[model samples]
Target: MRAFIAAICLFLLCGNAVANSVQDSTTPADAIVKALYDNLSAAYLCRDIVDADKYLKTRSVVEATMLAFTNKQDASETILKKWEDEIQINLKYQNQNISVEECNTLLRARTHQLYVAMDTLFK
Candidate 1:
C-alpha cells in the first residue's frame, strides 16, 4: 500500500511538472492562433466553408476578448482593437482571403507575436 501510494504521488508530481513546463513554453495566445490556423487550413482543404466560418467566428471572439483583458494601455489597446477588427473583416469577405499559403504566413507571424505578448504580459 505504501509503495503504491508513493508511486502514484511521484507519477502525479512528474506529470504536473511536465504539464506546467509545456504551458510555460507556449502562451495561450500562441495555442489559440495555431488552432485557428490549423482549423482554417483543414476547412479550406476540405472545401468546407461552414467550418471555416465557424473557426473565423471563434477566432474573432477569442482575439477580441483576450485583447480586451490583456491590453489596458490606450496605445496598445487601440492597436489590438484594430487587429480584432481586421480579423472580423477578414471573415466578412467573400473570399476570406485565406489561402493555404497565406494562412501559413499568418501563423508564423502570429506565433512570434503571441510569444512576445505573453512575455510582456506575464513579466
Candidate 2:
C-alpha cells in the first residue's frame, strides 16, 4: 500500500512538472506575438506607411528568429536580445517609400502569415 501511494505521488508530480515546462516554453513566443500584434494594429489604425513597413519587416525577422531558436535549441539570450534590438533599430529608421495602398496590401499579407506561423507553433 505504501509503495502504491508513493508511485501515485510521483506520477502526479511528474505530470505537473511536464505541464509547467510546456507552458514555460511557450510563454516567450506568446509574449512576442502579442507585442507584434499590438504594434501591427496600431500601425493599421494610424495609417502610417513607415510603421506598416516596419511591422512587416519585424514580423519576418521575428518568425525567422523563432525558427532558428527552434532548430538550435541552445540559442543564447544574447542572440535573442540582438534580434530584438535589430528590429528596434530598423523600425527607428523606417522610410515612407511605399504608398498607402501598397502598405495596406503588405500589412494584410503579413497579418495572415503571422497567423499561419503562430498556428504552427501552437500545434
Candidate 3:
C-alpha cells in the first residue's frame, strides 16, 4: 500500500511538471508576436519611420517600412523613440488587448507590399 501511494504521487508530480513546462515554452512566441505588433502600431501611429524600420526583421517588414516612409527621413529618431516607448508600455500591459486578428491583418498587408516592392526592385 505504501509503494502504491508513492508511485501515484510521483506520477502526479511528473505530470504537473510537464504541463508547466509546456505552458512556459509556448509563452515566448506569444510575447514575440505581441512585441512585433506593438512596435508596428506605434510606428504607424507616430509616423516614426526610423523606428518602424528597426522593427522590420523580416523582408516583409523592411519592405513595408520602405513603402511607408519613402519621404520622411527627418523623423527617424522620433519614430525610433516612439517605438521604444511603445514597447515599454506594452510590457506594462502584457497579455492585455492583444488581437491576433489585427496582427494577422497587419502582417499580411506588410508582406504583400514587400512582395510588390521586390518585384519592382528586381525588374
Kindly list the per-residue Cα lDDT of model 1 for residues 11-86, writing each as its tens digit.
3223221211234325444443334333333333323334456445545543453444444345334433454444
> Candidate 1 vs candidate 2: which has greater lDDT?
2
Residue 111, candidate 3: C-alpha displacement in angstroms:
0.9
For each candidate, the alpha-carbon lDDT, in order, equals: 0.41, 0.44, 0.39
Rank by TM-score, descending? 2, 1, 3
Per-residue lDDT tens digits for candidate 3, residues 5-119, read: 3443333223221201233323322222233344354334323323344344542452344234333343333444444455556544344453545545555564454355444
Error of 1 at 61 (Å): 8.4
TM-scores, all models, native as reference: 0.31, 0.33, 0.27
- Tell me how candidate 2 scores on lDDT: 0.44
What TM-score would candidate 3 get against the native? 0.27
TM-score for model 2?
A: 0.33
Ranking by lDDT: 2, 1, 3
Where does candidate 1 clash, by residue pair?
none
For residues 14-123, what per-residue lDDT tens digits would candidate 2 score against the true structure? Answer: 32212012343243344334434333443434346545566556545544644443443333233434444544454432544667776667656655655655555546
Consecutive 10-residue window with the lowest summed lDDT within model 1: 12-21
